[model samples]
Target: MTRTLVDPYSVPDELRPYLQEVVQRTHALCGSDLVSVIAVGSVALGDYRHGRSDVDVTVVVDGTAPGPVVPELAAALAHPALPCPAAGLELVVYDRNFTARPSGEAGYLLDINTGPLLPERASVDPSESPAFWYVIDRSVALQAGRVLYGRPAREVIAEPARADVLTALRASVREHSSGEGHLADNRVLNGCRSVQFCRTGRWQAKRRAAEAVAASEERFRPLLRAALHSYERPSRTAATTLPTTDVHTFLAWVAERVDESSDADRRG
Candidate 1:
């Protein structure tokens, strides 16, 4: 089955051919075990901007697929001939069983991100961290993502519960709370999305989520605008350059909001 969230005509013409080629190559590599290839992230959310967004993809495979499939698939897709669109490609390959009920262990067989500086691969080992799962469980993965092959996205994905959402947010906050290192612009916006989801029950792309919260939460406006500006720009260097102090402040606020939301949920 094929399911598309956005009209093919709507996507910038230049991106369409490249994205199609990527999908075709992916289908060729995964073969029969591939249950579905869904497009998540900004592209599916109608917020796609040519140079600013990454083309995110999720390839679901049969639970029983061979162990070598993932590594092989990764190598195959990582070929230099196949150029990526936007900032880069963010791809995750998940087993069907894992999609239904993700475990503490890394549910994905292959998780990779590729861009200019990191052209060949991105070392996002989900086994080492649960943050990957937190980002995957966002409602947009199922509700708005485009299915390029096999089963429809809705049939393949199991949306996380409210409790699960809170857990994920808390984990993210803890991981990023240390002020020693700076936070990426996307992480800041992701925090906004999580907080918004807890309070409003709406899933949004980063830009929209940041905008929504900035409008309502006066304290976050300047920070959110900074992030938004960075996100709109084409280069990583153009991204937000917040100081360590601001980064810590934002993370601490997110942690507090998450704690309060979780408490409210429990009390209710």
Candidate 2:
């Protein structure tokens, strides 16, 4: 199916009416079959940025379809007049069976039970796999989406706590950073660091310090530097492995330092 491009911000006036029409059309196509159409991703989270996002919508049918509906949905969204702004639309089709299984990709689970038609399920319990972070972090932002049937957007994503999501995010960042030669590893780490600061009002120059350390080395300097920064102060001991406790503690320290820096910034 051809993808539809959409402007992340300021949905075209034409687009709103088109979206309503599409939803109505989609509903009629399904016709009283128990199905749910939900919006998920950046637009759902109220965090969309223009020129850098797309629309993610999921269709959950009561029973498995003979074939994937993603292609069809894409085609519908890509209609010449409709023409989504970015790389068209991203559509996932699921049957009840598909929704029952835990999502293999971490943060991608839609949490259809409680969030909006398109809800952002952000909780990341440590017990959950690092894969969760990979999904959420790498998720393409959805500028806007609607539910064709069943449940409002807020009700679907409301159960998961922000803290749980944050924890999952942290684990994801650590996992990516630990993997060697991943250029985007630093981005994950920085994202986690930013979250930590926001949650606890603390900042660690760890990302910057780690970057410096990595740059100085000829090889995987960033990874090595991250490990060093994760260690407790004065001793400056480095380890071949990254223990979660040590990483968590280091994050805490970073947070404390950030708070201090913020205070200093205010005074200055």
Candidate 3:
């Protein structure tokens, strides 16, 4: 749906008027016919820090006419007043065809149908799936941040979801597993973060998945022995590769099982 959390009064003094002016100018330029324009990412979440964090904005329009509006909106945001001094602005344009889809993370969705502004939705409850953990984990650490629209940061941080929010963490670990070396290293790091969140019940499934990953390690002697009990040799040469696609897929499947079990435990 269309959600806008603009609070012009909350912007910093030096940046306040400029942002409001830009919004006004953009509205005038586009005849204000678009759907909603809300601030998201680090800034909207109030975790932004200066000299870091871009001015993240989302302008949801009515039709498929985003192509025509891009240049106008960009010019307005980048005008001399703001000049996009810091991390620059990320602009996303979503039309009616776009629907909120769950982001594999608890209650979160991929949000934008297209563009570079695929920032996660800020949930009211920190425990909701697809909460800001992805952003908290990946987005450049905010030196400072402020809301320029809709709801207050506290409000957004208080809403709860149907399930704990860590499911997305597990999904991210599985989905982005192709690269090796440093990329593989990043995946492992993210996997570790997922584990941390999961351990807190924010992401129950992810915690279990992390446990499974830890258990597979050569250092976890007893767990490895247990794994060896049920392990069966695959009939192919490709099966033994540590970083193979098959291995990742298998890990993801196992992770899903772990998540399911965690859910069952909660139910019981």
Candidate 4:
């Protein structure tokens, strides 16, 4: 359950082989251009659930890989060819330059989203997309990313600024507040995680963060419990749909919590 370098034990038993395949494929395909492939998110945090979680990977390239390699990488790791074993594979490719500098702005070369739960689309061109997702992801990757291939993550992926991560977490709270996120489980769990990060400066697995928040924030216990159930048992039916009004309310509370922490940091 330890989130360490190439820790296969943390990855669900069903996903270990497929994740290995991803690492092998990237090494064979990208060759020298591929500097490191780091496993981030649930798998890295030891909270991955079969059929529920996506295999999140961050690939760091040598920064010298040409534009042609982008398309080539896109084709090689595309779903049908690679066939992700988890719900989906959330793969992002970045250059060494992108990871070397520690900043608030997020940058990437390619974002390949494929699998059963995800749409089969390869998004390139960082300019077209908002930096929110990348910024949040990079923060988590720096904290918990485990190497799947090539060098160790910390050797390449620089730690993002603390203030930038707080900003990204605030953006996540705003997203859930607007009711625009794709997953209900994520909305609930991420809200808890964001508050924990805002207050503690620690990034934790969603379930653990929810549990900790629920323990101390008794008012949120029922909602956090429902969120945990949905995340741990994705295929099973929940007793009740997460109430939208309640969700918005929780997010509003989260925004305030984050704001309080941000204000505290400024004062201290």
- Give RMSD to native, each candidate: 3.3, 13.4, 12.5, 3.4
- Count clashing residue pairs per candidate: 0, 34, 26, 0
Query: What would the per-residue lDDT of candidate 2 be over residues 172-241, giving only the tens digit for each residue?
Result: 4555445443323234345444444444433334344354434643444444455544432222122234
Question: Of the pair 1 and 2, which is ahead by lDDT?
Answer: 1
User: What would the per-residue lDDT of candidate 4 be over residues 1-268, giving only the tens digit for each residue?
Assistant: 1222366665677887788777777776677777888888888888887777788899999865677777888888888788777878888898898789886665788888888768887778777666777887777877887777778878898888777787888887877777663567778888988988886787899999999989998887888898888777644233246878777778889899888877877898
Instruction: Give candidate 3 regions above 4 Å deviation.
Output: 1-6, 79-82, 100-268
Which consecutive 10 residues in model 2 have the weakest lDDT in total?
A: 111-120
Please say which candidate is ahead in TM-score: 1 or 2. Answer: 1
Residue-wise C-alpha lDDT for candidate 3, range 1-268, written one tens digit per residue: 2222265555545456556755665566555454445555545544343443445555444445545555545444553434544334554444423313222232222122211222322222324443344343222111123444332333223222224343444455555554432233234434543544444433222223345556655443333233222222221121122344534554464456447645865787
User: Which 10 successive residues of model 3 have the least lDDT summed?
Assistant: 230-239
Model 2: residue 203 alpha-carbon error in angstroms: 19
What candidate 4 gets wrong by more than 4 Å, as runs, is 1-7, 236-240
- Candidate 2 has a TM-score of 0.41
Best of the candidates, lDDT: 4
Candidates 1 and 4: which is better by lDDT? Answer: 4
Please report, in order, the local distance difference test score of every candidate based on alpha carbons: 0.69, 0.41, 0.41, 0.79
Candidate 3's displacement at residue 124, Å, is 30
